[model samples]
Target: MNEPCSRLAGVAVHLPETTMTTAELEDAVEARSPGVRIPRGVLERASGVRRRHIAAPHELPSDLAVAASREVLDDAGVRPAELDLIIYAGVLGDTVEPATAHVVAAGLGAACPVFDVRNACNGFANAIDIADALIARGGHRRVLITCGELLSAGIPWRIRSTEEFFAAGPHYTFSDAGAALLMEAGPAAGDGPAGGVLATRFSAESAAWALAALPVTGLSSDPDGAPLGIGRFDYDSLRFAAAFNDLDLEVLHKPLVEAGLRWDDFAAVCVHQAALPYLRAFCDRAGIPHDRTVVTIAEHGNVATASLPLQLAEAVRGGRVRRGDLVALVGLGSGIGAGIVIARW
Candidate 1:
């Protein structure tokens, strides 16, 4: 088989120090709605999450990104000056105008071209695709990809229904986290136990975009008091189950077929840690074994784009994956975007 030019050199993760247990989250939600009744144990079992970490009140996404990036660079033995590009792939940004990547680049003391990629949950995988192209075309020799998710900011605190649903399970499981991966040019550039990108396939279902979206119409600011608005987080569990199942099956088919491999070819699958139910449904539809799939959503909630790399770093750190192992990185998120990349570890 023909080998790819770019590879993943190293990976690092940064987790918040503050841990919030399922019961605590339930209490917080119940406080918002005194009449709401939610079972803490039910929420825990449904989400498969025991506790999650959140950033300190003053911490920002960039802070976590800088720490994670430094760790990755240190592990890769690559200096900041050597980096050619830096990409921040996450839903949360330091600001709306100046790209989060610019802030992260400045913090890392990296003098490289920087930008942000917003594919929602698929941001990391999309960033990897871009980095691979840059390395292959010689536009960049080394690229640093970072993602920081401040999911806490997205929580809908005012809505009684939303509060109840979140407290019920999936909402409490989200933890703040940041992750970084260093990608370098050349087929033999990877120094870690995992090899770089082997092949990648991407597919989009724009028609289903409305199925999972943060609709602007749902937001409204209170004129009398502190800024108060509703952020549309319309994720119908039933709709998601149908959409993601179809999307995953469609996306994985060509990638696996093009690579001339089957489900058993990969030793492990590192996919977006969106939620427990979504992950399990995708695996069932894709025919991927649960044991081969990595689950961090219970502990980290949905780190948006950072989920995949965080899972990969955990696999590497735990010694579950080794060199020359065929690993599949799958991403599924808003825009109903789904993509699969086969990497040799």
Candidate 2:
């Protein structure tokens, strides 16, 4: 028996309405803390993110997912009953109890077996890998992968010191968005000059997971009085960069080898939008040309699991990718997990 090839059926994105500029976030941070100050344009300069979309107060991650899912299903012309699986892959869910996929499935009236696949930001790509295997095994034909990240909502706005603000700066680069991809069984030969998934590979660097862990529960002082159970975040940017370099070659090599492809084979590369600087550095190390990658961080910020898919959607729509063009989806996230999926589009 041979592995079945999955075709790229459709991709879509749903962004929130509200936009938060760097200056606005800076002001919000400064105003909430009595003695803390963040210089104007600091975040913009550091992250290359001019602004980020923020969800409405009443909007949940599931809502965004459903919106994107609808667009994908409609584009693919796949009915809810025809879907074999639905995987909600994102950082935050509507509830910690019921799997977020459940809510999204209900919204779509999808009766398929649904669940969540979380690996920080690598979720969408990871879900694809799972779906790919299931398809190859012949149990499933169509799988829908969706992600909605609302990381911006988790920013603790009460920090009162330079250290706390700096620790939280990474949070500032996050945005809210949802994206979806539909993969279905297709002829392997169609990937050439047509859209299909060629191969996918995933790897991890668990040892470096602690370098960029986020939103851990901690104590914070309120201006009015007592301590509050606000979430705190910390990141060692230098350490993370070093770890990426250390593992870069191996991570990319295994995938290319297994797929029997080269970095130059891709017409465009879409990676996790960590930040503009880190993204550039990663591209440089991987020997992928700068122009060959599509970046959305400057305008969309780091949208977590939605990053890669959002980039892919934009690239496809913008004509950066054409039929038979090979595109690489590289996802790197906390837990230090990484994965790559090569598709023809």
Candidate 3:
């Protein structure tokens, strides 16, 4: 049997110092939109987000990604020159051109190939999937995946009406953060209770793309056919949930079962978390052990593509998981896409 060719070497996260509680977001909503009657504690009850971090005024997405990438690289004792590829997979970038990966590579003084992979919240996981294949091809030896999400900056502050506020509530729970993962090519480890990436599967439901979106492009105040204006967030949590509920993850879970791994077999399971309730619901529905997973949405809000890596970092920091343990990564994103990545720690 062919062995797994790539392994996750290190993971790191960087969260902005400033934080805003759900209560504060509600207060701001009322303050910004005097006409909108926002009942106190509503956002907190609905989203289950206690607070989230906010980036500094001068902070850019690349800045956060660079910080995390540097930390992970340093932690693994890997130098910038040793990297073969740098992929920035995040929701936002420093600018449209030059690719966010270029900024990250520039910060690391790396001259290797750099690119961007944008797939909503699934960006980071998608990069991992692609990097794993690249390493398997025997070309790239070391790959760096980074994401710096400054979603707080794009939050819709000015509310036109109560309906508009609720439709855009997902924005209020967003938090700014940066995360990175390092992967290296190594001797093959066959699919089993061994180290390295064991299996991966990705699925998409593009038909549900309009369930949630934010049109914050700094162009014409509002682009044609766009969902909202500057800082405008449009979301429908109910429909979003329904869409994902319909998403078929059998392909994702089949390999794990075939490998004789159950949910309890994992030392830690990291799933993309948007809200506390949604996280719990998804876990319950998927039969995932919630106790073995780190809950970040309640305290950290939704960190977008950084969610999985942050959970892994938190688990490692807390000593809940260690080397040689089996772990699983489940990714659910705004594209209504889902993916599964199981590996040995």
Candidate 4:
């Protein structure tokens, strides 16, 4: 007998109502940090992000996750009680302990085993791989994977100097959003309308992890009355770009090789929502046509861990992807890690 595999049953997303255009963000930067100059169009040009949603101060990651989770369950025609497992797959969570999945599960009235799977930006793809394994090995039928990003929360509003602001530049491209996916055990490969995951591979470059990092600093009260604590992100953009291209060339085709397929076999490819230039470069290096790729970074910015699923959902809604078409899901996260999943839609 063939191994049981999971097929994507449904996908749903939620975005905050507040939008900050690139121009507006620059303006805000000027107002918040006087004397620091972010030239017109520089932010958008650097990140390829036109605008991004900002979560309300009171909105938590769990709230966004629940919103998307409810919609996905409805889309899949499944009840909360029907879920055998719930995995919160996001880079940020509601708190430091007890697992963010617990909060999301409770919000959705989900009575199931709950946990979290975090892999920076590759979270959604990683969760899918885990769910597929459980369904195949443990006989779990239905699983829910949800990710909510409060990316704006990490922005340090009060920068002490131009260098500090410059270090945070890459973060301007991040947006607040949530996405969820419902997967269930399905017939073997080529047996259903919702196709099974044909192959998935995850790789990491630990030595290069420090190339991108989000570190929290300033725990003690400051005499200047600034916030007691703040989150700061740093990255070597040039190094990351070069490393990303090299890694793609090395492993982007592993899944295809493992599955004995070719680029022509996929109808669409959903790469992580990073800068447009990086996406274009990756596609070019992989020999994938521009028309075969889906990009959300320009419009939504990078939604962090929700990026992959959000991209996939957007492509489906836009008709860029269709049932019976094979698509590739590629994820590149700050962990300096990459994950690829090739599936038939």
TM-score of 3: 0.92
Write the residue-wise lDDT of candidate 2 on 11-79 in tens digits. Answer: 999999899888888888889889887777877888889989999888889999999999999987889
lDDT of 4 by residue, 310-344 (tens): 87898888887778788888888876888788887
Runs off by more than 4 Å, candidate 2: 1-3, 189-191, 215-231, 257-260
TM-score of each: 0.88, 0.91, 0.92, 0.92
Q: Give the count of colliding residue pairs in each prediction.
A: 7, 2, 0, 0
Please give, for residues 54-167, the per-residue lDDT of candidate 3 as tens digits. 999999999999999999999999999999999999988897788989989998899999999999999988999999999988889999999999999868788888887777
Point to the candidate with the largest lDDT: 3
Alpha-carbon local distance difference test for all models: 0.78, 0.83, 0.87, 0.83
141: Cα error in model 3, Å: 1.2
137 in model 1: Cα distance from truth in Å? Answer: 0.5
Worst 10 residues of 1 by lDDT: 217-226
